[model samples]
Target: MKRKDQMIGSAFLCALLCLLMAVSGCQSMEDQNYTVPAAEKSETVNLKFFGNKNEALNVVAIEEILKAYMEEYPDVNITYESVKGADYFDVLMKRIRSGNGDDIFMINHDTMLELMKTGELADLSGLPTIEDFSPGARSQMTFDGVVPFVPTSISAFGLYCNLGLLAENNLEVPETYAEFLAACEVFSEKDITPIVANNDISLKTLAISRGMFEVYKGGGAEKALEQMNADPSLLAEAMRPGFEMVHLFIDRGYVDAGRTLKTEKTKDDLADFATGSYPFMLTGAWASPRVAALNPGLNYKVYPYPAQEDGSVLVTNVDTRVAVNARSAHVEEAKKFLEYLTQKDVMWEFVDSQSSFSPLEDNRLSSDPAVQPLNAYMTNGRSILGTDSNLKYPIWDLSKESVRGLLKGQSVEEVLGDFEAGLKKSQPGGAQ
Candidate 1:
């Protein structure tokens, strides 16, 4: 009986020891720090970027920037897709509808406004990079006190002069409207085309350059725009001076209306100007490099449009704006990319590649000899924002159509009447 009892006690002791050991193991696990798996801790973030500038050089530059960013941040993977042609906006809209919009995207001023209305663009107001931009540039990108996009470059429209042709005619580059007209007369007498006009944007830019400062500047623009937005007819009255300037150009035979109306912008105009026959081309400064590439020996310079008698005004469009998608899953990562792009060296390289002016406050003056002359106007605050978002009406489209009417041999009054009619049609319950 004693032997059996001792054996039972030994079995009970063994069982108790095993229970204690199991409890000790449980406690050890409970007391220890939990570690996430390596894969879970280092999940990769993927970002997609969309843009419209699909030129070979632009693609290469963008890829280089993305590669450098990825090198600095290993876990981030960015895929860039650039769509060519006017179909880009359509493609972007389709993507957004399908819930596959890019994390970051390029937008123009008008598109930014449209996207902002739909809450598609992230509010980038308090970003550190915002302070880097000049006030004028910031204002252009701002709507209702919210900055929805960052402008990468400023697109300046100017008069591209054939210095060789100007010298041959004993005329210095025109600095005033009067001087420009006089130069045109000289070229007319010599049977040389004074200006290369195109069907697209030449007349619109001309009117903006001539009358933007007078009508839109000096702190009354907001009120004037409000009035015009309320009463569409007031828009024509405000734009009269600019349209009159267009009429004068046609009436003086400075530009052949039929030829100007038929010529496609940046195509035929660029080709004709490259032949060294036209003294001036009314186009954007971005065309300077193309002009050089077309004719390596062409002596040329880009100057502000001779819009004033005392001085010239530079008409600039803030362009190549980038915005973060508000619905992006990787919002922080997308913002980091924008901050990277805003760095001085990176921004400079990108802006220079586009042959555009930087929007940063400390932007360096363009080194291109052709674009250097307009630096003074930029520094002196004589530059006007050509692509304004303050106005409620579609000023740019209206201006283009009005100029088209002018090109079709309509008088200034007739064109203004058409402009008023179109504005009335756009009003609610006015017309179809």
Candidate 2:
């Protein structure tokens, strides 16, 4: 009886040891490759993205991109709404204050700077996509030492060359101010409009080009910015060269200011260009697709506005921003979507479809052969952001009006004087 009892106890001990070893093996496997069971996965997450891309083309392009994202991450539902126009920033701020802001949104320089100071945007420094941005682009998006936004596209201002027109005239694309002037003379003699005089095309582009020449290329960017920050009158000295360039165009009959002052830019300019009546148009890259759509077979290309004789300065700006709301509940998932958008393949397609440049150096958006001249300046660190100089929003308006004033027979000095005065008033800190 005693021997039988000892054997039973030994068998029980053996069973207990086997159970312990089995549990240990399971834990070791878990440590090596842990995954939650299917039942433990989270429910579908919905994210909202609000932006100012309300135009037809913009909406369609963005929707298509989002569709691909949804297909990949079926568990996520995204809603995109556009809130553009004068009250966009006001509406965005109200939503944030109400604790109902979008998971992600678009931001511009002025708005982004204000939101950054208020701590309304998320810090995106840890994102993998941050490593892919061009230094110029990354610096523009960063605020107060924290990156709160990333640009999706670069806004480049250049001349739209009607290659067919240039070829017909036997004029090569202008490489310098002298060449540009000579081209104008040849076009004028042929009774052709050398450049569109519309507000959207001529003035704004020329202003940016001239601004870059004076501020960035001339090495006055730092000093001029400091003076503007100190007092607005200093802008007049910096802007003189650019404003004078516009005056020269008017004086030489290269641009008809009186007609341009009264003309509707979008309608008149598009119709004129579509007829192949003009040889050149000055606009941003945003206008490229529209131009192509209007005249499908027109042979044209965009080149950086010849700011210098050597094509040394290109005027570029951070055109679009993808920012995450600091208070978002779906931060991780929103970040994932942002990451997806910046992937090389997706970025290239987006840039190509939108007719814009990518903001990443690693994935440099190749330019059309006609517009490739601008790329050299961009790659050589000779580009300037529109917002980086004295071209603040208010100053932009003043600059536009200055051109109109010059076209309407106002003297260049008078118009520039008015601009300086208006800029001073716009400064919140009071002119020193």
The TM-scores, one per candidate, come to 0.84, 0.76
For model 2, state the Cα shift of residue 224 in Å.
5.7
lDDT of 2 at 385: 65
Minimum summed lDDT over a 10-residue window in model 1 is located at: 108-117
Residue-pair clashes, model 1 = 0
TM-score, model 2 to reference: 0.76
Candidate 1 residues lying further than 4 Å off, grouped into runs, are: 1-44, 55-57, 83-100, 216-223, 258-264, 421-432
RMSD of each: 4.8, 6.6
Report clashes for each candidate as comma-separated counts: 0, 0
Q: How many pairs of residues collide in model 2?
A: 0
**What is the Å distance of residue 407 in model 1 from its true position?**
2.4
lDDT for every model? 0.82, 0.74
